[model samples]
Target: MFYAVSAVVLGFLLDLALGDPHWLPHPVRLIGWLIARLEQLIRPVLPKTPRGELLGGILLTLIVVGLSGGVSWCMLHFAAVYLGKLPAYLLEVVMCYQLIAVRSLKAESMRVYRELQKGDLASARIAVSMIVGRDTEKLSPAGVAKAAVETVAENTSDGVAAPLFYLLIGGAPLGFCYKAINTLDSMIGYRNEQYLSFGKFAAKLDDAVNFIPARLCALLMIAAAFFTGLDGPGAFRIWKCDRKNHKSPNSAQTEAACAGALGVQLAGNAFYGGVLFEKPTIGDARRMVIPNDIRLANRLMVVTSLLSLAAFSLMKLLIIFLLH
Candidate 1:
């Protein structure tokens, strides 16, 4: 239990300092590669019918998640049995670090901020495109900034808090399970003609796993807003009012808090693959979204991540104490 707690802390610090350097290989990317390979192998064997595709998706999920969690568990177990606790702890720390993307989220969003600061709307659009799923070709300067902020807000829950929640609950193995689900969803979970039936389980499972952490992260974000002098009451009010603004049950939780805290509207509509998705607007358009809002949203995300770590760590420790 102590090692679990310490791994989370040190992993978080490592992520903050290193922020996913491109030189190092990431397990998540390996997971993604594995998913693609499995999909290629699985799809060819299944029928083209909806039920067949659905069954294929289920098998894919089971294999990917099982392998991810099982491999991590084996690695740690073998390391502890043969090498030492310190080596096992170090492997666990790296595993925990790979599971979360707090610093990477910030660094990616800030590229847009830096581009916008230079008055390079074109460059800003390109930078924002890397992070956002929407079509960025036709976005204006404000649109670029809004997209960046919205990505930061939504990812606060998905990329940071949700992983931390799992890490605290079940250590690195369970955390990898969560990431496998999340990565599968990102890779295949879509309402498009190709994925509608094929990715249903992954999509639903992602929603299920993220439900609690998303709301918890929003609450932490509200408190972070208050502490950072953004707009605590407004955040709470908007969260209460607009938490369900997205088609996704979990995506809007943090977006609403962030929009209200920053005093700008977000998530009205977005073009994806040239098709416009009409999404409900969250928060009132109290002010125009600016490039600086990206920085503020990052601030909120960082603070919320710290609060989640501290709170979940304490919860984990308390549970351990009770168990002992």
Candidate 2:
């Protein structure tokens, strides 16, 4: 138990120090490859009928989630049984570090912030484009900042806290399992005409899995805001008032909190695939989003990460003490 908590803590630090090194082979990428191959093999065989699409989608999710979790568990079990405890702990650290995206998320968003700082709208657009799914080519400087802030806010749940929560409850296998589900949703989980039916299962599953973590992360951010000298009460108020403004069941929870904390309005409108989406505005437009908000957003995220780590570790220790 000590080693488990230690590994979780160390993994977070390592991810901060070395955020998603391109050279390191990532399990999410491997799972993505498998998803593409399986979808190709199975999607072609399944009929194009709605019933067939639904059945095929279910089969696809089951195969991906089951095989991914099973394989990861078997690997970890083999390491623990055959290798020494120290080696197993090291493996856990590496796996956990790979799954969490604390530094990478901030790093990518900061790129947009830095570009915005340079007053280079085109470059800022490009940088924000890398982190966001919406169209960035037509975005203004404020639009770029809002997109960066929004990504940092929403992904506080999806990219970091969700994986960490699963790691605390289970371990690397469960963490990576959660990552697989998130990756699936990121890749094929769309509501477009092509994927509306075929991707419904993965999208819905991702929503279900993210439900609790999204809310938890919102509260964490609110607490973080209080500690970091941000607007905590305003965060809570806006969160309660506007958390459901977005169409997604979970994405807006943290975004609303972040918007209120930073005194910025977010999610007004955006283009995706050449179509402009008139999203409901979150939070009152007390102030326009500035480049510094990105820095503030990243600060809030790190504080939340550290607080969650401390909280989860203490809980694990308490459980260990009680069980003994």
Candidate 3:
């Protein structure tokens, strides 16, 4: 129990100090490779029907998640048995560090922010495109900034808090399982004609796993808004009124809180693959979103990450105490 808690704290600090380096071999990337390969193999074998594709997707999900969790657990068990507790704990620390992505998210968004600061609209659009799913070829400066801010807000739940929550509940093995699920969704969970049926299970499972964590992250972000001198009450009000503004059941929670905290409107129609997606706006148009809001959003995200770590750690400790 002590090692589990210690590893999570150390892993978070490690992520903060050294973000993800491109040179490093990330487990998420490996999981993504596994997912892609499985998709190829499964798609060829499955019948070209909705039900057949759905079955293939479900099987792929189970294999990836089970293998991820099983492999991580086995590695830890072997390290403890052969090497020592210290070696096992170190391994867990690295795995946990790999799971959470707050620092990398900030770094990626800041690329857009920096490009915008230089008045380089084209480069800013390119930078924003790297982090978001929307088409960025013709975005205005404000649109670029809004996209950066929105990704930061949405990922405050997806990239940071959700992984931390899973780590608290079941350590790195479970965290890897969560990451596998997320990777599968990001790779194939699209509503496009090609993936509509095949990706249904991945999309639905991602939503199921993220449901509680997303709302919890939003509430924590509201508290972070209060502590950071943002519009805390307004965050709550807008979250209550607009958290369901997105098509996804969970994507809007943090975005609504963030839009309210920054006093701006976000998420009103966007282009993807040259197709227009008419998304409802979340929050009031109290002000136009600016590039500096990217920095502010990063601030809120970091504060929310810290708060979730503390809260989850304490909960794990309480559970351990109760069990004893």
Candidate 4:
């Protein structure tokens, strides 16, 4: 229990100090590669019918999640038995670090902020394009900033909170499995003609897994806003009013909270694949989204991530004590 708790604390420190080094191997990317290849093989075997697609997606989820958990457990088991518990525990720390993404998400958001601050809208569009699914070519400065802020808010739930929730409950393997579901959703979970049927299962699975974590993320972000001197009351109010603005069950929860906290409107019509998508707007437009709001959103996200780390670690210790 001591090593497990230690690994949790040290893992949070590692993520903040060294947000995914470009050189290090990431399990999420590896999971993505596997998903892509598996999709290629499996999609062809199934008919284009919904039943076929559903079964194929179900099989894909089982394979990817089972493989991720089994591999993690086996690796730890072997290391503990062969080397020692200490080495195995340290390996666990590294896995936890790799699994949770707080600082890396903030770094990417700040990259867009830097480009926007330089008065380089084109470059900012390029940077924002890295994080958002919408078309960035014709976005205004405010649009770019809005895109960045929205991505930060959405990822706050999907990337940081969801992973930490899983890690605290079941450690590295479970966290990795959650990442696999997220990766699958990101890659193919869409309403497009090609993915509408094939990606249904993945999208629903992601929604189901994130159902609780997403709401928890909103509450945490609101608390973080309170401590960070943002508009906590506005966040709560807007979150309550517009939390269901997005089409996804979970996407809008944090986005509404964030837009309210920052006093800006988000999610109007946006171009995707050259087609205009008129998304439901969230939060009253008390102010236009600016590049500075990107920094503010990052501050909120950072604080939320820190609080999540501390809160979940304490929860882990409690669970451990209760068990023993």
Q: Per-candidate RMSD vs. true structure?
A: 0.7, 1.2, 0.7, 1.2
lDDT of each: 0.95, 0.89, 0.94, 0.89
TM-score of 2: 0.97
TM-score of model 1 relative to the true fold?
0.99
> TM-scores, in order shown?
0.99, 0.97, 0.99, 0.97
Model 2 worst lDDT run, 10 consecutive residues: 307-316
Candidate 4 lDDT over 16-78, as tens digits, reads 999998898888889999988998999999988988988888888789888888898888899
Model 1, which residues run further than 4 Å from truth?
none
Worst 10 residues of 3 by lDDT: 1-10
Query: Worst 10-residue stretch by lDDT in candidate 1?
Result: 94-103
Off by over 4 Å in 4: none
Per-residue alpha-carbon lDDT of model 3 for 29-90, expressed as tens digits? 89999999999899999999999999999999999999999999999999999999999999
Off by over 4 Å in 3: none
Clashes of each: 0, 0, 0, 0
> C-alpha displacement of 148 in model 3, angstroms?
0.6
What digit string (tens of lDDT, one per residue) describes model 2 on residues 53-122? Answer: 8788788888898888888788878888999777878998998899889999999999998888888899
Q: Could you tell me the C-alpha RMSD of candidate 4 in Å?
A: 1.2
